[model samples]
Target: MDPVVLAAGSALVSAMATDGWQQTRAAVVEWWRRRRPDRADGVGSDLEAVRAQVLAAREQGDEDTEQALAGAWRLRLQQLINEDPALADELRRLLDEHVDPALSDGEQPQHRPIIMKAEARDNSRVYQAGRDQHITGS
Candidate 1:
């Protein structure tokens, strides 16, 4: 899992401001730079791309994708907490605000695949990519 993603997850659990999210993302970028020095930007775009996709999905009224993204964020947050226990308190607080509400009502949305095309790619990849990945049918 991406450490930057983990940090983002932690932020979700803490109601972190947008600047906090950018800082966490920056740390992840730095870590990625250290690990893959030869890759130039070293996959910096992945996280930004994911963030953008999530925002776009929210704007599109894609509830299922939104929920799944939230779940993924939660998982990443858990991973971050496991990696650094000191953040537990912060994470717990965030969960109290963001996660608990969804759980109490069993309001997690179901995934609704929106496939636009199929060809060289297999169904499994399409499924794994989820709605966002399948939208372009690449």
Candidate 2:
């Protein structure tokens, strides 16, 4: 998937979990209104429905479901970009100016991949984590 699609999808999901989600949702809907007017009417309703699911999933401790919803959205965005290759720029702007800042921490895990490498030789040890790591026990 395109980086913008990945970031936007993940940020969109994160923002859905926040208190200011209505504004985020509205911004996305307006994007559709400008770029895909034909699909705009339904998009707001669809986003609201998705927001319900996101809340439900969070309540159920079902992060996977939330991720699946993001994937569905990513696919939707990818299709939009595919139809109009130039839309990628618009999507990037949406993600940057609106979607990402909506995140509580301004972090999009899917925005970039993390890779770690270590060579532990001669009684050495290596440990890595994308976020947090604790080594207890000497």
Candidate 3:
């Protein structure tokens, strides 16, 4: 999947759970309106339905369901971009301007790289990881 689509889809799903979802939703539907005016209304309705489902899944503590919803939206966005290659830039702008800012308002996410290394000698072995790890020796 395109990285912009992936990021936008994730940001869309995250925005749906935030108070600024309406703004993000409007921006999405407006973009659709410009591209395919006939489908814009339906797309808006569908977005609402998806948002409801995402919220319900989150309430039920169903991470898998939420992820599946995100994947669905990602695919939809990918299709749109496939049809009109120019929309890719618009999606990126939406992410940077609307969706991402909404997500960052409360608490910024933390990202850290993880590195792992292993070495073995004739009669000994070593295993290491910055986080989780599993190892077997003989």
Candidate 4:
């Protein structure tokens, strides 16, 4: 075989391989999208549970404790989102509503935030105190 032709063939093969890889990646993403829950519509348990826990803590007259817990919870959730990029977008959408509610409007609930999960409701979102954006799911 001519050296020039061989080299050209090798380059063509390499380009084909790169294109195939790109297609595979796009397919995987499309599949994941089909599996992904609606960020705006899907209700998560992680945030709901966190909200309940914070509310309970506050009701127990532990305002400081509640704040600490909420902060830790948010950090952990953010971390989990980092681990699973899809979850981050969902979490962000869900929390966007309450991130800074208009408390002065008297419409904001006095209770804490609710932790929600993208999939299972039984699993709780756990936060590690003193750690920023570090989370573990139950």
Best by TM-score: 2
Q: Tell me each candidate's TM-score.
A: 0.36, 0.77, 0.74, 0.31
> Each model's C-alpha lDDT?
0.48, 0.85, 0.82, 0.38
Comparing 2 with 4 on TM-score, the higher-scoring candidate is 2
For 26-80, candidate 3 gives per-residue lDDT tens digits of 9889888998999999999999998999899989999898889889999999999
Clashes of 2: 0
lDDT of 3 at 9: 77
Q: Judging by lDDT against the true structure, name the best candidate.
A: 2
User: Model 4, 3-43: lDDT tens per residue?
Assistant: 22222222222222232333432332343354454531222
Candidate 1 stretches greater than 4 Å from native: 1-46, 90-138
- Clashing residue pairs in all predictions, respectively, total 1, 0, 0, 15
lDDT for model 3: 0.82
Per-residue lDDT over 23-64 for candidate 1, one digit per residue giving the tens place of the 0 to 100 score: 555554564355445642634565665667666775787757
Q: Residue 11: error of model 3 in Å?
A: 0.9
- Relative to the true structure, candidate 4 reaches a TM of 0.31
Rate residue 100 of model 3 by lDDT: 83
Regarding lDDT, does 3 or 4 come out ahead? 3
* Candidates in descending TM-score order: 2, 3, 1, 4
